[model samples]
Target: MSATRRQVLARTGAVAGIAFTGSLTELFAGTAAAKGMGRAGYGPLVPDPKGLLDLPKGFRYRVLSREGDRMLSGEGEVPSNHDGMAAFGGRRGQVHLVRNHENRTDAEIRVPAVRGLTYDPEGLGGCTALTLDSANRVLGERVAIAGTSTNCAGGPTPWGTWLTCEETEDKAGTNGYTKDHGFIFEVDPTNPHRTGAVPLKAMGRFQHEAVAIDPRNGVVYETEDAFERPFGLFYRFLPVKPRGGLGSLRAGGSLQAMRVPGVPDLSAIQETGAAFDRVEWVDVPDPLAAETPIRFQDFGPKGITHAQKLEGCYWGGSSVYFVSSFARSNEGSAADHYGQIWRYDPARRRLTLVVVFGPDTDVQLPGEEPDNICLAPSGGLMVAEDGEGAQHVFGVTTRGEVYPMARGRQNIGTPEEPAWGEFAGICFSPDYDTMFVNCYTPGTTFAVTGPWHR
Candidate 1:
């Protein structure tokens, strides 16, 4: 009998949450390797002459947009610090992309203020919309939303919109202008000319990183990216009226935080094969927390279980896969870890660690802090590395085989250092033939294409 994909991954310790003790490079040793090629991906990475990026053989990239370039809308220059993004289908073989600019303060270029679209005139973060042909060639770009704060890693909605989140909990009058900062804003990619960007205030206000929606039940799972005393919390927003559909998210919802039944502290999950217990959600008294920040609110004595740095999250195969960027022997916890991937089964209420990054000595696959992960078109997963060392995009197959897909080689002469930079805003085109990603600094967006399955 032919084995299913899940069965194959389970056999290789990819889905079974088996303990792995080996060098980072050795993680792929069990996989079949090609002559002179790496263990999993398309051979070895070939360095680019432009000192921008390095990709495996046969794969090439083209810069779709730059930070300082003029906007296709002819309004203002393109902003910097591009972050989370999603691709949508457009008219006549065209693709629409909604990209986030993670600017917390005044940026190099600001999105022009329109009437109903502007949230705060002084705010400095928002999203941009781009139009590309079926071939992944960029045609035009425009500002979709403006005057939001710290537009960070957001998720794509089932109703065809990008839910851009704010990675901050700053309230009104603290910064410069008015209006609270930490709110999720929804941008419609289909109509770039339409404004009236609305903040999903019904969804709890906290340091939101990314969110994944369960299509079967309209439940939205959220991750917080906090660096304060309380750390981050994993939350779920269940729409009160399921029949209202996607619009109910803005109407209102019950916000709840996740908790492992017996485990009082999250630090217990420090080991390689650290298995999760049956998960439970506790009602958050105040979802909006209009008076106080939501994270600090005492849900109870136990409070909401906290993760070190909860980041990227995506919905895949009947589960929500989220990343804990890094956990260590900090004040709150005991275990030190480079990275951890947690899978939450909405149907079963089971949360398990599918994969954990080995010790720092695992240098060959130095994806220390995996952020902004997305499902590959053909199979497997692509992770954007946001670590202290040399950064690269790592590919993980169903069999747990890990290999480098792309490397950042910033030009030495440039003002930014060549040592390190992160690859963010990773997503595939509607056709899945090309991959779109961004380099955080000296901002550049690239469209990568090649034999993805090979």
Candidate 2:
């Protein structure tokens, strides 16, 4: 069967089930076995090798908190469709986590807003702040703040702030209060008073999925999350001052979309190293003008457009890595499409194909849908798989080693039988010892850690 066809079948057959027995054992033995695990190699951390929520020999996971759970702020409970998250150091012995709820006005997660912020009070699309202990246990939870729409995926600022992004462009009716639906909002875990919810209009409005801030230079790199038709664009926001702070982003800056010069079409140059591939930055006259900052429209040799459905982006070392979740490959092009990872080196001002998916002899997982991504502290990239079949959290190392980290196991409302699938939002704690994963459809987050062995 074709990859795309197989993916469709896999999605239909995917089931959600809960593994209670094995999970208990893995949790207790995980910590003790870590010391002797030997350099902590990388491999599938899920206990069930056949495919389930269960972890491996010495690993276990506990749901920190699920949507619709009450918070300490007197706010009712969390909504569903949780997405990207940021972890911060709290004042006491707790750590603060700012999580995003990717819900629309029609399906809101009602929560009282932090003073000065306005919320639907019945919408699920908002942000939450929760405190956790060292072992990844939830100590307390708060609304943190509310009043947003389709809060998809965003990045963390160096100034210890979370920039939650809205992923939609539907700005009519109740959602029309905002200038545009595509903008970044700043949230402060330390001081909720100073950091109320507000969109940063200076950042050109687009279908933003994730943002990556340059610590050295306050440049904000953004990626769009659209895969329907023409696809989306990749953008970079440069503050007026070369070394300005995060606050400067609010003042305004030059917003530019990326275009590969000489490569009118990405598919043509897919195989060409394309050395440097002169990048052109188009200026945005008015960020809120519903105008795209990109001037050039082209694709490379592989039939991959210059910026096609740019999903997750992150800054590593001196370069920025972004993923195109729907780029075509050299092998049999599936209907749904395979994805590719590209790196833009600031020093060289060039774009390089770091990894290409589909028809690979190595990791032969079918389907090509990719989502949010993060750098694994252990020296590799962890990507959330959004493809068909059991969605999985995959880890690709710098050496091109692919490992499945976790799988989604949900209860399909049937006592006689349950289902199991894949998961997204694969992130590591500040110490990198503990890993947190977000399950999309079921809308749950799990903390996984233990003696890890490749």
Q: Which prediction has the highest lDDT against the true structure?
A: 1
Worst 10 residues of 2 by lDDT: 18-27
Task: Give the number of the best model, judged by TM-score.
Answer: 1
lDDT of 1 at 67: 88
Inter-residue clash pairs, candidate 1:
24-362
TM-scores for every candidate against the unseen true structure: 0.87, 0.80
RMSD values, in order shown: 7.8, 7.8
lDDT of 1 by residue, 38-72 (tens): 24577677868887888878999988888889888
Compose the digit string of candidate 2's lDDT tens values, residues 160-191.
Answer: 88888878765535454443466788887666
TM-score (C-alpha) between model 2 and the true structure = 0.80
**Model 1: residue 417 alpha-carbon error in angstroms:** 5.8
Cα lDDT of candidate 2 equals 0.62
